[model samples]
Target: MTTLTVFYIGLFYIAAIIFFGGLAYRIYEYSRTPAPLNIPTTPAPTTAGGVVVRMAREVVLFESLFKSNKWIWVFGWLFHVGMAVVLLRHFRYFQEPVWFWVEFIQPYGKYASFAMVAGLAGLWARRFMVDRVRYISTPSDHLMLALLLGIALSGMMMTFVAHTDIVALKAFALGLLTFDWHPLPADPVLLAHLTLVAVLMIIFPVSKLLHAPGIFFSPSRNQVDNPRDRRHIAPWAQALERDNA
Candidate 1:
């Protein structure tokens, strides 16, 4: 293997460790955190089943975002759905036979980058164009958008502009899974795309990107709004009460 291949193998190993490990720890913390009140947002679900349906809507449809702002919802939904399809399409690289769905989406994923980039551009523009958003926006937000944009643009260049050695690339991806460690193509654009992806993974646990998982644990969104029918006691509070008794 070339030095570049060894370096990337090591880099990806580290990035995977940080990404998965850190995300798991953060999720555990969120689970353990207590909600002091039954404070689901108004018009919230009252039953467990209702909460499930509500969460489904929030996750898949971005219901709250849609209600709050149509433009933001459009951009956010476009980015998320396109990125998801692109990721599903990438499963072709890691699997030997490749699932039928993955094969089917290859053509769609080829063009999904355009939607992804367009969505990112719209979102990035919102930061500058909206006064309240601009006031609260930090450097990290801009940096995250730029990083994603870089990855999408570089990927598009590889697809539409300068084709990389995809056979070699797929070998490298499969190698990572099988511990075989194939040599990676020395294409600069491909390298940049992979590097940006790695960077995004490493930062994801610490960044606002945590919202992807954090939404599930949100008190306002996930709580059942039945305080009147049932006494709301936090797990920690219940323990304390038992000890007192």
Candidate 2:
């Protein structure tokens, strides 16, 4: 294997392991950490079915955030929805026979970069311009935006500015999946994009990006507002009672 191939293959494997392992650990911890109180946000869903619907609306429409701030909601929605399409489009790279649906959306996904960047720019600007947001914003928050902006811009440059050998890139990606080594296109933008992507994956579970999964564990969102219907007891509190008995 060539040095570049070895380096990337090893780096990807390590990043994959960390990404998945960290997520599993985080998820397990969230599951075990009980919400001792029935603390669902008020004017909230009452039934389990209603909770699911609320969550769906929250995920797809950013309903709550939209009610809070329209501009932030607009930018956040554009970036996230564009990212979903782009990620789906990228599934073609790993598969030997790309799915027909993935192939069909390729063009749309390629251009979604514009929306993604536009949204990120709006969000990044809010950090500088909005006093409350700026006060709470950490260096890591700005750095995360920089990393995402870098990845998206570099990718756009690859697509429109200086196109690389995508065929070779796809082959390299597939080879990594099958343990059959292939040479990567030594394109600087592509390399930079991939490097940023790897860092993003490795840091994702540990970063605020974990809000992706952490949202599922949040008491305000996940808990049903039904204190009258059933008693609420934290697992640790129950355990203490059993020990005393």
Top candidate, metric lDDT: 1
For candidate 2, list the clashing residue pairs, or say none.
Answer: none
Put down candidate 2 lDDT per residue, 77-138, tens digits, no spaces: 99998888888989999997888999999999999988899999999999999999999999
RMSD in Å for all candidates: 1.5, 1.3
> Candidate 1's residue-wise lDDT over 1-245, tens digit each?
89999999999999999999999999999988888789899888889999999999999999999999998999998888888888888899989898998999999998888889889999999999999999999999999999999998998999899999999999999999999989999999999999999999999999999999999999999999999898988888988989999
Candidate 1: which stretches are off by over 4 Å? 239-245
Question: Model 1 misses residue 45 by how many Å?
Answer: 1.4
After the best TM-score superposition of candidate 1, give how far the Cα of residue 182 lies from its true spot, in angstroms.
0.6
C-alpha lDDT values of all predictions: 0.93, 0.91
Decoy 2 TM-score against native: 0.96
Global fold similarity of model 1 (TM-score): 0.95
- Superposed by TM-score, candidate 2 places the C-alpha of residue 227 at a distance from the truth, in angstroms, of 1.8
TM-score of each: 0.95, 0.96
Clashing pairs in 1: none
Weakest ten-residue segment in model 2 by summed lDDT = 1-10
